[model samples]
Target: MLTILAAIAPNFLLILLGWLLRARHVLDGPFWLQTEKLTYFVLFPALLVTNLAEARLDGLPVAAILGAHGLGITLVLGLLVLPLRFLSPRLRADGPAFTSVLQGAVRPNTYVGFAIAAAIWGPHGVTVTALASSLVIPLVNLYCVTALIRWGSGGGKRGLGATVLAIAKNPLILACVIGAALNVSGIGLPPIVGPLLKILAQASLALGLLCVGAGLEFSALRGAHGPVAAVLGLKLAVMPLAVGALAWSFGLTGTTLAVTVTYAALPVAANAYILARQLGGDHALTAAIITASTMAAAVSLPVVTLLIGYLP
Candidate 1:
């Protein structure tokens, strides 16, 4: 238990610090916008590109891990979509919006997951997890975008070409593709290039977390507790459990299994709201779900750590 707490303490501390910074108004709106832009458009992509470019590809159960995480997420999302009665009139009004919000709630936060992996399992773990994330993030983003757009936008018809364009144009996806190409080509990063990438990768997590914390809100969840809790349960509990079982069934054990399950247990990506809002989904509800799931992950992540620690 002590070891588990020790592994997770840093992440929780960062969140608390970000919260405190917001409480003291150290982060203004413009600062947050800039921070988010830098994190998403530059730091995150650089991190993904660099980490994945040099990842060791030998003997990794890459497919099984990615499949397990995706399957777990899909199942949880499907279950969350089931129609439910909200007795509260206020909640009833917000319920549809909550569905889109909840989609973001169930997806893992890759930045935080990679940071935790580094702390818990060292640099090798970081590289492996980053590679896994490179595969996961684009797919998850597409899923969220598709779901929120279809559900919240009142069934607007979208062309497949536009969807493909969106995926192609996403900075994160583009970074991942470039990284994979570099990795497969067997050309090592040049001297200056490696350091430059490392600098960006290192800054990605802390800055991203700070902006995420600054964006957290309680009022969005106040009257919609039931749906929020439901999303949290699926995200923090159900998804990890499903990932563990599916990963085991597919013959993934040891570090691969540990990484997959731990990441699956991570909170929804903080950027989910930004994406939803950008693409015309329910922004307020997405914010609420992001806030609730992130808080719950403080507990859920430790539980996953213990599970992985005890793995045979």
Candidate 2:
């Protein structure tokens, strides 16, 4: 247990540090906005491309890993959407709020997942983390965009084509595709370029965690208690357990199992709020969900790590 805490503590502490720095006015809103943009567009993608481009794919359980994780997410999407479809208009009336519930239930913080996985399992762990993200990101985005279109106010009118275009243009997805292509093609980056990308990848983890901390908003939790609680339960507890069991059933073990479950257990991504705002979803509820789930992860993650350790 202490070993698990040792792995989990620094990640959450960086989040706490970011929160503390923001609360003390050490960094203002605009700084964090630009920082987030830099992390999302430049640094994080560099990390993904670098790690994945150089990853050893030999003997990796790519099919089983993607299948297990994908199945878990697909099941969760149905679980949330189907019941909501039959609910009273008053409960489901707000399009944006419904979108928030969807985002909160499924999205995982890739930045945190990468950091924690690395801490626990080193480079092999990061490889599994990146691979899981490559497979999961597109599917999660597809579901969220579909929810926004079906339930969101004005944006739903854009139709399926726009949603497909948006997912295609996502930087993270593009990075994943490029990186995997390079890996499979057996092409390596030039010496100078490799070092530069390595440097950026290192910067990404620290800066990304801080940005996650800065994005946390506590006030949004005030009136949205019910939705907030439900999301935390789904993201932190239920999703991980479901995904872990499915992955085990598919014969995934060791680093692959650990990384898949860790990703499942992560909080709702900060980008959930951004998607909510852009698509006219309830950004406030999304923010609250992100904050609550992230805060809950400090406890939930250690428990998850221990549980996976006990699994065959």
Candidate 3:
């Protein structure tokens, strides 16, 4: 128990530090935005490319990871969208944005997941999970962006082709794809390229999480408690537990199992909220969900970490 607690304590402290810095106005919005952009557009992609470029995906339990992640998300999406489909006309207007917020609440924050993965499982685990995320992120973002845009646009007739094109143009997804290709092809980046990417990847964890904390909208959290509760319950508890069971059923163990479950358990990403607001989705509801789930994960993560330690 103490080992598990010790492993997770540093991550929780770093997030709290991020929140404190933002609360104290030590990190301003423009700075946070620029940092987040750099992380998203440059650092994270570079990291993914670098880490995954040399990975061997053979015998990696890719199916289990994919199954756990996909099934959990599919179930949560249906649960969120069905009830939202019946809201009043006026309230129904907010349904798409509201559903987008729910997606954001349930989606895991890969930045935080990466940081904790490195701390608990070291370089090898980081490399492997980076590889996993390189695959997972593109698909996840594609679904999220499409859902948010479609709903926010009132289900207007935008072709699926257009959505695919839009997702294809996303820089983050592009980077992940390129990285995964390099990994599968067994190509080695030039020495200079690898080092540069490594530096950015290292910086991404702290900088990204700090920007995430800075972006948390306390004002939006007010008057959204009931919806926030439903979102948080599914995101922090249900989703992770579901993933854990799937992982066990498949006989996954060691760091793969630990990282997989922990990744599943991460709070709804801050980016989800940002994307929601940008696309006319319910920013306040997204904000409420992100903030509430992130705060709750501080407790839930430790519990899951301990559970993983006990797994056969």
Candidate whose TM-score is highest: 2
Q: All predictions: root-mean-square deviation over Cα? A: 2.8, 1.5, 2.6
lDDT of predicted model 1: 0.75
Q: Model 1 Cα displacement at 305 (Å)? A: 1.1
Cα lDDT of model 1 by residue, 38-76, tens digit: 999999998888888888888787788778877776776
Span of 10 residues, lowest total lDDT, candidate 2: 82-91
lDDT per residue (tens digit) for residues 37-81 in model 3: 898888878777777777667788878776777776666667654
lDDT of 3: 0.74
TM-score ranking of the models: 2, 1, 3
| Model 2 misplacement above 4 A | 88-90, 157-160
Deviation from native of the Cα of residue 235 in model 2, angstroms:
1.1
Error of 2 at 20 (Å): 1.2
Better of 1 and 2 by lDDT: 2
How much is the lDDT of residue 208 in candidate 3? 79
Tens digit of per-residue lDDT, candidate 2, span 242-267: 88889998899987898888889999
Task: Give the TM-score of each candidate.
Answer: 0.90, 0.96, 0.89
- Location of the lowest summed lDDT over 10 successive residues in candidate 1: 82-91
Q: Residue 182: error of model 1 in Å? A: 0.9
